[model samples]
Target: MLCALIGSACAGARDEGGTDEADGQGDEFGGSQECEPDPRGTEPEVALPSPHEQLYELELDTWGISNAGGDPVETRTRMNEALAWALDNGFEGVRIPAGTYRVGEKTSDIYTAGIELPGSMDLILDPGATLEMAPNDTWNYCVVAVRGLEDVRIAGGRIVGDRDEHSYGGADDEGHGVCVEGASKRVLIEDIELTKLTGDGVLIVGQSEAGSCEDITIRNSELHENRRQGVSIVGGIRVLIEGNEIHHIHGTAPQFGVDIESLSFTSKDIMIRDNSFHDNQAGDFVNTDGTNVWFQGNTLDQGDVTDQVDGPIVFWKRTDQTIRDNVVIMHSPTVNGLWGVIGYTNDDEPRANPVPNYIEDNVFEGGGIHLARNHGNAVIRANQIDGWMILGSRLSCLRLSDNAVNKAEGESYKFREVQGVASGNLLNGAPVALPMSDDAPFTNSPPHLW
Candidate 1:
């Protein structure tokens, strides 16, 4: 059932179930907002020490790239030549000057046949340069790939995909701007612009069981206007995505700012902090099945966009997530109604798992909590909500405490056939009894709009 939303998104990914910023754009868009420092009392363990300082700090033509004018054959030859040079005499770093290098050609392979990233080096492009993937009719193609490598960093410049010129004859929807695949570790991608992709702007997908990713960090980037997701995590661990602005992810299913869904392997210890997310088609964030994922201090806004399919956030019951200190502004709800966050991606039957989730210290303006059914053990505490609180129907061991919801005078907390402890909560300046009956606030008509 999870594959319905992500099956096509994971075209080259061997995981059958499929997968699963920039600075702030515009003035005062909060796209450049950073996270609260050391919430866990420590910095992330990112291994990005560039030790190859004395080796290869040269320019574009030094690596046999004389002319870069988006010619597929010539650019591919130059790229292969550069790659061969890097392979022969140890790659340290290379800089591409201000130019447009179009990669990929018709003679390349169908799946993932593009410019591959060399391990243990730095590929720094000039701020005015761009690496554009040449238009092809393939389902799977990566403009820049970091496959099964370590100690790599890609910074500066822009990497554009082939969404506009793709012929769509491959009959699949995976043409990423940059693909970080295989068992790669210690990779860092920062201060870059990734946009106009047929699939995700960037995809961190594991090809098989022996090729998952770890210790990955993507920060200070701008990813937008992708057909699928801004970023898709098919398989990864210890991934931190911070301080990016992601928006307007339309034209596909499950089009979140980030979709973390691992099928065969485990993807744990992920953090998405201090990002500005808005105008996404499906939602801002959705964890189909990720472990120990934290969404901290980000701004998720569903502004005047009325065609939102999913809400701002959707997480399955199997995830061990901690969502705290984020600001959710919801002007319009999705097909799942007005609750800004949901327990499932769709309005279907919920999955009942025993994982622990903490939803603490968040501010929801015109939005509310919707952790209905026996999803998990949720601790919903200390939030200022301006909308409904629909946590009902056999939710076990729930803790609803110290939350202030805007309700009518003499109104009570509406929970139907639920098992929970509700204390220190206020609805319309009154502390109505939540456990007074099976459906204490509303006995028959339990507040359900979807």
Candidate 2:
């Protein structure tokens, strides 16, 4: 009867209630009735892992390098030789002990780099180790230069540039602290202190025709008081810059903390997050013109100091970009004729068409956000602005929603021939009702009156 009901033949006889008599005896219809113990009743023993790579110490004193600072010409020569030896002998890591090392001119006409890190090397510096640069006019100036390398890691050091010692002769003659350029890949630079450079603190450039240097990471670093940008990326891909402190950058015209652009190609897939930017000389704390870039959780403050910064962020011809969860306080009196918390513009023809830009959940104080002649689809939502907001003359398809704008001196929202929707926004604690309709407007004409 049980086999007929279950549509299968039973291995043993069934009881009166249609239960298998051999149910607990490894029968086909049943299993053993005994309970099993849990395997995770006790914690498993674990072992401490070994270091990822072997460490090789380079004794500067053994190479006739002194801790007492002097002319670094000889030291630079020995340092490069040691680096070559390490690379040739297949060393994975090298450590420089704590000391002050001065680097100056290597030859009469050429200034040598303090250290040049090659491919597949981990260079570690002791906590008190310092590399000080002396003044020179050479264009090949850098404290650490990594060129045409792959899989390099530079961690824990102090690089002080010769800003006081060197004279700047335009942009070409300036020196950088750390430069990674020319076909470099998988470089990790972290936990370094860079200050008082004649040019920029760090520069990642791609000048090669083969391809732009890819997969670079810069984190937990401090760059301050540099002549130009704190960190400048000319051309690179998949770069991650996070948890950095950059400030007091005042040398060139656009003295930005991070400047991302390209001279030959397009820079893409870059992420800048959780950085602290304050007291920078220019208003554009972060200036980017790259595609698919993300800037989040960054804090930009122009302290009570007058004429410190002009704006928090500026983007040009960027696409698929996002700026969210950032607190930007632009309280300084406008300097260098630039003022705004956020600035967007597109002037280059064959323009990439800065579209689909999302600026949300950001807090802006003192100054407002501005859009200048942009012809893309943008969404400005859920922002708390303590100043005025301006839309340029040629903007199209903009959606502004749920934003609170406290009027500062002038108008709360200024529209200059913009075509967009203003819905659920608050201007001085009242709902804003602009004359927006479901109709396509003509070119160079106002969407509706404010």
Candidate 3:
């Protein structure tokens, strides 16, 4: 992915070497296998490991968190106390040993679950420890809540949500495994296994006075088998999601591996790189309202497990994105595969965009790119596309150059509705005039992508 339309694009300072790969031995999503130092990105950006000093080993009997595992309300009360005990006692780090603690509480209309952390602390869960959210009827719940805090690190262990025992008769069902909300900054959630939620594996939402979380990193983690999304970034700045396997997102609409749809322009400088995305039901990713978003170096594979509904990647009318250096594999030309690798669209009428969306250096195994509508500028360069190169959309300017195109099917359409220039392209290894005029080019029609 290309590196947004706002302030400045921030990059993570890495150490060296690759992170530990998922063992992939038993289950689908694999384990919290303690990834090595520095996450592995296709572009090789490393995450600094959180330091641990003066770390206190918390005892379950002393903290009394596991004693009330059978009772939801009591567990929530004890869990909150256990998390705060260390911070209040002048400690910067605490470790929870092996135990299964069920937690949540309902008071009035608001329901709170999991352990909420304070600022400037490190919370480590032992290898066998599992913090499971209790069954509830509320529409919103979180297994771990990091709300409006700063300089927090949550690592190791597993955070499981209440998907199997959740009541589904209600309207809203947003039970996330982890929630990082408010204007929280300098947060790192790494090497954890979060799965089986009704909502998302992790939801990084901005609900504070600043309107966004800053400098957040979720890396070397496994987010799998979630109901809605693997990672939902409603608002975050300088966010990095790398070296993880986000898979098996199904049982709902817009079920993507990572969804970066912020309210207004709240999200910018977000990078989704070097991750393995496979068997995601709807698609791998979708950037609806993010600026300066880079979706690069990720491996997206829609195997025989499921049919993709929204293709591999889809973006709304944002011209400040870079989608590059990705290996997108489409199993077969299904409904969304005709125009598969990446798709762009807009619902309302034309609008002006200053920046240009760059789609470059991508290797599309059996897919291509598609632009539907709206007046935005785009640059499509140096891609190996085996499917449609349909660019009939209304745009401000389009630069199509140095791309190799080979058709999956025999038929190809003409492009009579473009407003840019195409040059140095190869159609089946032959120099073909781009933006092929009505009878010369290949283009997708209006709206309604099947």
Task: Give the residue spans of candidate 2 off by over 4 A.
Answer: 1-52, 106-111, 171-173, 284-288, 308-310, 318-320, 335-339, 342-354, 435-438, 442-450
TM-score computed on alpha carbons, candidate 1: 0.84
Q: Which prediction has the highest TM-score against the true structure?
A: 1
C-alpha RMSD in Å of predicted model 1 compared with the true structure: 10.0
* lDDT winner, 2 or 3: 3
Superior by TM-score: candidate 1 or candidate 2? 1
The CA-based lDDT of model 2 is what? Answer: 0.65
Clashing pairs in 3: 1-295, 1-296, 1-324, 2-322, 4-292, 413-442, 414-441
The TM-score, computed over Cα atoms with residue i paired to residue i, of candidate 2 is 0.81
Report the lDDT tens digits of candidate 3 across residue range 77-195.
76677667777887887887887778887653546566777657888888788888887777788888888878788889888887888777553347788898987887889899998
Candidate 2: worst 10 consecutive residues by lDDT? 1-10
Per-residue lDDT of candidate 2, residues 1-450 (tens digit): 101211111121111122212222211211112212111111111111122286579877677776666668877777777877877887787888888888766454545467777557887888888888866766547898888877788889898888877754545334788888886888888899989887788888886575677778888999999877788777877788889999888866457788776657557778888999887876434444567677888998876547653456766545456787888887654532223444444232322343456778888887667654454456778988876553433344566789888874655665543456668888878897765422342223223331
Q: Order of candidates by lDDT, top first? A: 1, 3, 2
Model 1 scores a C-alpha lDDT of 0.70
RMSD for each model, in Å, please? 10.0, 22.5, 12.7
